[model samples]
Target: MSNLPLTSNKLLSTLSSSDYERLLPHLETTDLPLGQTLYEPNQPLNYAYFPLNAVISLVNILEGGQMVDATMIGNEGMVGVPLVLGTMQIPMSAVTQIAGQALRIEASIFRSTLQGNGALYSLMLRYVQVLMGQIAQNLACIRLHSAQERCCYLLAMMQDRVGSPELIITQEALSRVVGVRRAGVNEIVNTLGRAGLIGHQRGKITILDRAGLEAAGCQCYRTLRAEYGRLSRP
Candidate 1:
């Protein structure tokens, strides 16, 4: 109901005027704090969130209760896609990995608007495609890349999504996201810091040199980035 600019969320900003107007009344702006659980596995989703600056991580829980990152959703896409697709449940857990804000809409209203098969539906489908692509690429990267390379890849991806060089995340969180041990994460962080690619202090990571980080990362980083750019273009 807020007439605030939708420009922060690219997915919403791309909606045609008519489609945007239809969904505008139902939209409410909200903040997403770090560690906020948007939804749990197999639970009904109550709302669909279009992130303005927040980054949500979709994680798969292993049998032993370890959480491995599946993919991350930022301003380029929406959370709660299961609701839009007519299913209220998702197998993975959704959490706010970064503290920021977003625009949200009730699940039922979002579903009805999506059922119209208009621009929102089409755009969301494209977003899903990109999401799937990134997940698949991550799978391969995890399998074939070294821990250091994977760390660089994750940092690069997060930098692009958040549109900032400085990230306020703990090493433990980075380890979980990269599916590596904390020791390994520390090693990678130290390596990057020594190379002048990044500065790490406390829980913050500042990208001192973007080009250097990209060069240290695996090819999957560039590949997924190019795919996202190509698929998500208006």
Candidate 2:
């Protein structure tokens, strides 16, 4: 029997049984630790990862080493899209934003499978389109939203991805992921805590009131969720 766990990953789980079987032999379960670098800027990808509960951040570094988080991939998507789509090198760096497990497959095998002109290829193309939409939405959010609104949106999104109200992440790390300064992150966090919208400890946060958070966050979150729901549906 194949040892792969009953996958919670949206992409993999949505695959047709025949498509799943075709890819099964190449998949191996892997532990994705926090802060793990999956790929670096301009680096050749070796594998694609479908995260079950983990979240990966794609960061783009500026000339002076200022890094901005471009997008995030969780259970709904896979890493190494460029590899399967014909690009040999990835432009952004990918790192684990939260610790969890993923099913990984060799990039070569994945690419060969993509050439089969089957359901998997079509599905991956749709996923890539949805992922691009997320990136575009983030760009708009960053330009038009406040730090507090963005923070709430981010926390709310993480809650959905992790399937829990509570999350284990330090403020410093959160700041990096949100592309905000530590003081700004603290200010937003403090506001949320004071309002009882969320509970924050040293390195953990819990969503005490999802409704409150939804009200505080930007509309981009809802729009993004709707798009993902529409595009990623089986």
Cα error, candidate 2, residue 173 (Å): 1.8
Best by the TM-score measure: 2
Across residues 1-234, which tens digit of lDDT does each residue of candidate 2 receive? 123354678778888788888888888888888899999899889999998777889999899988888988888789999976898688889999988788899988889989984788888888899899999888888889987888888888888776678887889889987769999899889999999999999989999999999999999889988887876454
Question: TM-scores across all candidates?
Answer: 0.93, 0.94
Worst 10 residues of 2 by lDDT: 1-10
Tell me the deviation in Å of residue 70 in model 1: 1.0
Q: Please, what are the lDDT tens digits per residue for candidate 1 over residues 1-234?
A: 233357678777777688888888889889888899999999989999988877899988889998988988887788997875679999999998877788999898889888874778888888888888888998998999998998998898888767689988889989988888999899989999999999999989999999999999999888987876665465
Worst 10 residues of 1 by lDDT: 1-10
How well does candidate 1 match the true structure in TM-score terms? 0.93
